[model samples]
Target: MTADLPLRKIIHIDMDAFYAAVEQRDNPAYRGKPVVVGGRPDSRGVVATCSYEARKFGIRSAMASSQAYRLCPQAIFVKPRFEVYRDVSAAIRRIFSDYTELFEPLSLDEAYLDVTVVSRCRGSATLIAKEIKDKIRQQTGLTASTGVSYNKFLAKIASDLDKPDGLCLITPEQGPGFVERLPVGKFHGIGKATEKKMHELDIRSGLDLKRWPLSLLVQHFGKAGQHYYDIARGIDHRPVRNFRPSKSVGVEITYPEDLAEPNLILQQLIDLMGKALARLTAKQMTAHTLTVKIKYHDFVQITRSKTLPQAITGVEGFEAILADLLKDTEVGVKKVRLLGIALSSLHSPELLHYRQTDLFAFSMPSHFPN
Candidate 1:
């Protein structure tokens, strides 16, 4: 575990309404006016991103465009220009690379940088973040929000505290108190379902979560419980790696309407598995862990996973596993809105190395989120 080591400087940078901001920058009319970058208002489309001006009217990303229209009818809705976004993203990446070689891009508009050993800007992570933000504004005519801290979790959270051209810092002295005061739902990995579970147990804030015994959390939340235990105490050890190995690869489909027919659902699963297998083949990797995810009409989601003794490459071998997983779920009895298949514990033959001292090596528990 690296917990005993000295703290490192980590920074998380997220562009402010990246798509919408670009539109506003290119088109002068959108300045100080609400702008939305997404699908048409009349279609069954969702808002991808909206300007801060639009947010005042309660418009938000993922809200149906129709609802966003009802919230602010005059808001300008523009389709996404992914190519332009990619160009701007590359420009930002160049700026980041100048400060630190340790870059872990979370998405096109967000990334993490480890500047613990970086000498640029006099080795000040905060100064590096400011300079990066300034360079982005100068080059792309766009604004970004930045957060600086000793770990990834806090750095990410701080970035959102004051958004739209904001910069915030959470030092080691502030981390514990900041986490304690934060709402339980605000924890990075705790989704709506987990938040409901936490609330059911009278855990509404980080302080409340911290008071619970680690075993109790594990018993209630499975592997995710250990994650909750550590973050509540402001203990996250996840590193910023230049290359993050894909933990799992999968594809999922959400139907417009709930599916009731067993045969139809099986067909969907088969199609999904075919797509997953194709990707696995493309990567030249084999998977030892298979998981099937089901989301009911009411949005209740469950995953059934099975681990094989050895990795397999053929799609025919997964049929039995898929059937068994479906049989264990409530897909047939209840309406299903989504179905997915994921492959994990992957290994590439070319990447595997043998050692005489050990047959295989497992990372310490601290290597993961917990």
Candidate 2:
């Protein structure tokens, strides 16, 4: 609606079926075959990601491994090799830095680049996106989909318009009409629950949402209503930040089979703590809170956390807290599907500046492991 605002050049780069593609690239046998990368089919595992081939049979990420197996019995299921993926992610990030320093990584395989002032490819954001796609293919032997737009929301939407080595763009002039035709559920922050609510209100698309009064939206969704209103009009002013400080670091694992034994769960916690602690130290951060999470076989998840007077800097301190939090849960009594330990209330030299900045604040000031 407003034409006076500065036009920012934003691009969203998403690797095409990242984890599944990596597996296929490294192992030639997986090529042209459906590959699911995550937990095994016999366990309580879920699909992390799947090849487009798997998608033909409706296999998707977060689906139960067993269900995926049932969908396509011939599909090859493999465990995740995060270390290899991490290496590839790092390599791609280095490639991103060559174009512009103003990029935010959403995950290992997805990132948003703000190249409003970038000079590479003669300052053409579209060309920049094309070059990036080419470089990723050359360097990592992987294909990525790129979306070029004036903001993150539209850019991300454009990226998904095409898949598996596709490039799409939505210009400022096209933003309004593009969003109007988009489904409410396809909007970035609108999840399944919100989509259901939108359906009840007949707010099925961006055009439908734009018709509702701001007051009505707020009455229905509280603070999130403002976001809905802004996005409906194709308004998103969020910046592409260069630095993202960690609020916490932790490690977690989902068991192949539900473990009901205290000793086994305890051992898993210990292992998780080691990885968590190592990550915390690697980031030069300290935590004052330790939280233990347990998910039972029935899918009920609970967390117990303790805030210490002093920051924990060693494994022994973390172990003590873990033991206490574990005791607070009914892990041994119920079959546990997943166990996780997290250290929060984090502090580090890198975060100190943001902590002191009055402009910055976390709505939820705690972090959890991915």
Candidate 3:
């Protein structure tokens, strides 16, 4: 037994239903409504995440708005305020910096902070977590849940045990036993799909999971199977990396007024595509996924994507592909309203760097028969 395994005190903090919380914080009128955030249901938009009130009516993020409408027609729907959310995320990240240099943000609303190596704040992780929660609520008018344990797995799982202004700390003594009794779905990194697979294997619970042979697990589940064996006994060795670089860099625009002209739309796409392609050059990355998002006047939205065989790393090449998609969309000036171009499958600047060429005034493609 490695008694000297560096004892870590990690805190996982997640804001309670972030976007909806912001709406409630800003508007008194929406406080009690079943707030659904994301694309509008009538516009063929998808749910980002619904408030608990909306969730009660069987709404969730990634579900179609029509389905959600069928479930709860009376729910209040709102678009995502990502700019405000990003600003709030920055403010909360600042608080983490005050505690330790070892902060790892999972998303806009969640992060894991390792406080074991701190020389100044000497006390229980629980106390620091409580103080952080207090500061967040005071500064942002938002509530967050905290989970503290020796490793990230235990810490993340512990945080979810109690949610929406909850704190849980799992000591080594309690960690293993807790994992044994945990429902398979509660394990970190276990998605809905994996939970179903585990169910088929008769791994109804963590105790049942612990009974699977290592070879069989590896045969069926590959590397994740090995990960399963370790967390079943509450073991995780991943470190917190805070200066994490962004993978893809792109820009988007929402039409204050819905556009209808084809030439006007294509011209706008050119400008937007120019900016996005320029960003790829600035970041010195290759984009594997080229996504063209079209939002209609009625607010119904559709996103089309093409993952290329070759990684695109320049303005001219990527923009050409984007223009092709735009031209083929066939949703002409009358119906088409907003266009957004995004590039993903990013290669780090470490892998590549900015390659610049002065070619902004490229000619428009000759495809549409006038």
Best by TM-score: 2
TM-score of each prediction:
0.72, 0.76, 0.70
lDDT of 1 by residue, 109-214 (tens): 7777777776666667777677777788898999888888778899889888898888888877788999999999998877776788889999999999999898
lDDT of 3 by residue, 1-370 (tens): 0466666666677778888888888888888788887666666555667787888887876565667889999888887665577677667767766767666655567777776655433456776777778888899998888788878898787777787788887887787898899999988888766899999988977788788878888988998888888788777878866544556556556654566656555545555554565445433456888788888887788887888878765445554666577776656745765678788887765653422211100000111011
Per-candidate clashes, comma-separated: 0, 0, 1
Candidate 3 — which residues are off by over 4 angstroms? 119-121, 245-370
Best by lDDT: 2
The root-mean-square deviation over C-alpha atoms between each candidate and the true structure, in angstroms, is 9.3, 8.3, 14.1
Off by over 4 Å in 1: 1-3, 247-294, 298-370
| Candidate 2 to native Cα RMSD, angstroms | 8.3
How far in Å is the alpha carbon of 206 misplaced in model 2?
A: 0.8
Residue range 1-370, candidate 2, lDDT tens digits:
3567677777887889988999999999999999998667775466778999999999986666778999999999997776677678777777776766776666667777877776666677777777778888999999998887778898888788889798887777788888899999999988766899999988999999999999999999999999889888888888887666777777666665688877656756765665566556544468988888899999899999888899776655455556777887787789998878899998885665422110100010011100
For candidate 1, the per-residue lDDT at 111 reads 71
TM-score of 1: 0.72
TM-score-wise, the better of 1 and 2 is 2
